[model samples]
Structure formats: C-alpha cells, structure tokens
Target: AAALISGHEDAYDGFICDEQSVPAAPGEFGVALDASLAVWQQKGYRGIWLKMPAAKAHVIGHAVDRGFEFHHAEKEYVMLTRWLPSSENKLPPNASHQVGMGAFVMNERREVLVVQERSGPLRGQGVWKMPTGLVQQGEDISEAAEREVLEETGIRARFDAVLAMRQAHGFAFGKSDMFFVVALKMEAGPQARELCMQEDELVGVRWMGLEEYLAVPFTAARPLFQKIHAAILAYVNGTY
Candidate 1:
C-alpha cells in the first residue's frame, strides 16, 4: 500500500501537489498519485499541478500514466499539469513575453558604444546599433543592460536609468517581446576606450559620435529607434 499524498488548494479550485510528499519508490509514487487524483476529483478540483525535480525524474512516467501532461521545465524541475474537469480546460498558458534589454552607453567624450552584428537581421548590413540581449532568468533589466554592454564591447558601464521601452507581438515562436532601452555611463578606466568585440556574434565594436549614431540609415528607418535616440539624447543632456 502507498502512503497518502497531500496537496493544497489553488486559487482556481485546483490542486498543487506537494513535491516534498512524493514517494521514493516509483511503484509507491504511482499508487499515491492515483489515490490523490481520485480524492481530488471527488473534491471537485478542476485542475492539478505537479512539480517534479530532476532528481525524481523517474516518477514522471507515473504521472504521465495518470494523465499529467508536460507544462514547462527549468534546469532543476519540470511542471506537469492536468485538467480534471470534463468541461473545457481553462488553465492559462505559460510565459508569453520575452524580455530584452538594450544598452545606450556613452563616455565622457560623448561617443556612444555601438556594435555591428555578424549574424541577425542586420548581418553584413554595416548597421551599428546599441548592445542588446535577452534578459536572463532572475536578472534585473539594469543588470542585463550592463552585462550585454560588457559582453559585446568589453566596456564597463554603470546603469543610469531606463531611456525607453517598446512592445510588439508576433515575435519569435509566436510570443511577444518587451524591449527596454537603458542609459549607462561608461566607467573610468583604460578598458573603457578599448574595443574587445565578441568575435562570434559581432563583426565590429566601436564608439561613434552620438550625432552620427542617430543619423544611421537603420535608425532613420525605424520610428521607435528614432524615439529611443531622442530619449538617449535627452538623458545625456540632463533633460530626461
């Protein structure tokens, strides 16, 4: 016989299994899970959420055999979800927005940091843009901006403030994107003026005059880019 499984009720009248209460043996886990599902159904639970850590991956097959479907996964754990109700399942989807950060780093000489990507939409186009990258999990926007600037141009900078934000739908994999443009002041040191471009991702990294950056063909073509340029200018001029 398997031990009783315990869980808590969720806001949606669902059940969230206590991962710590999972049985050690796969057979015991299967028996406990089946009993829990039957109890939950009798209690009128509409959905069930179960998180299985990588260490307990062997038990995932048991959950699948009981009707749980993969919802999402991270490095340490995987989330499995199941709709218990016979009616239409109304559980919300996983994360839908990808957050990105752009760094507008400028030095005392008023030259802005820019990079020419070796790959991407601007590859081989001679278009220079601010260093940008996706915000990693558990990273702040400002920290991501600083990290991107450092990784792409080898320039250390301090985050000042967010200059602008842009949102759009129909991005990669049918998900939306939220882009943040942030202002950063270059740190004083020999590395500040040195160029050490990331070879694989960038063909060139250099500092260009702010006016020249704003006049680039790529910048002129996009209204949002022009707006971000204006915001950076305002921030530098202390009028932001």
Candidate 2:
C-alpha cells in the first residue's frame, strides 16, 4: 500500500496537504490520498486543503475522484478543497475583495486629465471623470492607476501617492470593492500632452481645468466626488 500523504492540521481543524509529500504517480497518489482522507475523517477533521503543483497534476484526478473540488489555481499550482463531514461545508470562499484605482493627473496649468467613458453607467451622460479601472491580478494600485491613465488617454504618467480610498459592497458578482484615488505626475514627452484616446472604451480624453471638472453636473451632485476632488486639489497645492 502507498504511504499516507504528509500534512498538518490547520487552525480551523482542517488538514493541509504538503505538496512536496504528494505521490508522483497517479495510482500511488490515489491510494495514499484515500488513506489520508480516511484517517482525517476518523479524527473528525472538518476540511482538507490539497495543494497540487503542476508537476503533480496527474494526481489531481485521484483527488477529484475522492470528492475534492477546485478551490483556486495559479500558474504553477492548483488548490483543491474537501469537507470531511456530511454537513454543509464551511470552507471560506476564495479572495473576496476586488481592487480598483482612479488616476489623478494634473498639470501646472491646474488642469486635470479626464476621460469620457464610452461605456459604463456614465456613458452618454456627459460625465468626465478621472481615468479609472480595476487592478489586475498581482498589480499594485499605483501601477493600475498609472496604467489606466496611459491606456485611456495615451498620456504617460508616473505614480505619486494614494490620496484617498473608498470601500463599498454589493459590487459586481457580490464582491466588495476597494477604490483607491491615486495621484500621478505626467511624464515629460510630446505624447504626454497629445490626445490618443482609446476609441473602444473612451469617447473623449482631454485636459480640463480643475474648477471646470469639479463643476460638471455629475461631479457637483455627489458629495463623495466633491470631497475626493477637494483632497486631490489639496495634495497638489501642498496643503494635504
């Protein structure tokens, strides 16, 4: 018989399998996994977390056959989960927060970079807001902010400091959202001032005076927007 998989109990009374200890062969892995599951169940373990590296992917089928479900995956590995008891599985869901950022780029002329989104809630509403987008996996908020500014307006900018943050629930797919308002400095180049708006996602991109932007009907109507813009202005004026 194959040796039982090596692992330790988690704080939540769950067993976390050691990836390095997983059997390389499918047949051996199946036998070892079964033995481990039996032992865990006998010990009244609540859940089992199996981390399988890409090299041991062949054994993933064995874990699945034993009722393990995919929890999440990365480029080099996959995480499988199983609840030992028959009662409802209390295993916590994977990553619950979605991060987003808005780029606040201003020039010496007191003009801020703004974009007219071709789609989204503000589309066709004449709302000119700061360039914003969701942060990609493994990307930092500052990086996302600069990237959004560059992508939407074709104006290169360097990350400064995060001026403010807002959190809200009931976002897309029931995930919580973390919105970061980041200050960015426009880079020195001809492209920095030229307009090359992303046609698919933006209808227009331009530099609007701070007061003009803050006066937009949409911006003027929302207190949050009012405060956020005030904060950005304070940061630029060295008063923040």
Cα RMSD to the true fold for all candidates? 2.8, 4.1
Instruction: Specify the highest-TM-score model's number.
Output: 1
Residue clash pairs of candidate 1: none
lDDT of 2 by residue, 1-240 (tens): 558888898999899988888988988888888888888899999989999999988888888988999998879999999998899999998888899998888887999888899988887987888889999989988888878887788888899888989999989978899998999988897867676889999998888998898788887898888789789878987999
Global lDDT scores for all candidate models: 0.88, 0.88
Tell me the tens digit of each residue's lDDT in model 1 across 139-225.
999999888888888888889899899899999988899999988888887967577889989999988998898889978788898
- C-alpha TM-scores of all predictions: 0.84, 0.75
Model 1 / residue 189 / CA error / Å:
3.3
- What shift in Å separates residue 216 of candidate 2 from its native position after superposition? 1.2
RMSD of 2: 4.1
Give the true-structure RMSD of model 1: 2.8
- For residue 99, model 1's alpha carbon misses the true position, in angstroms, by 1.0
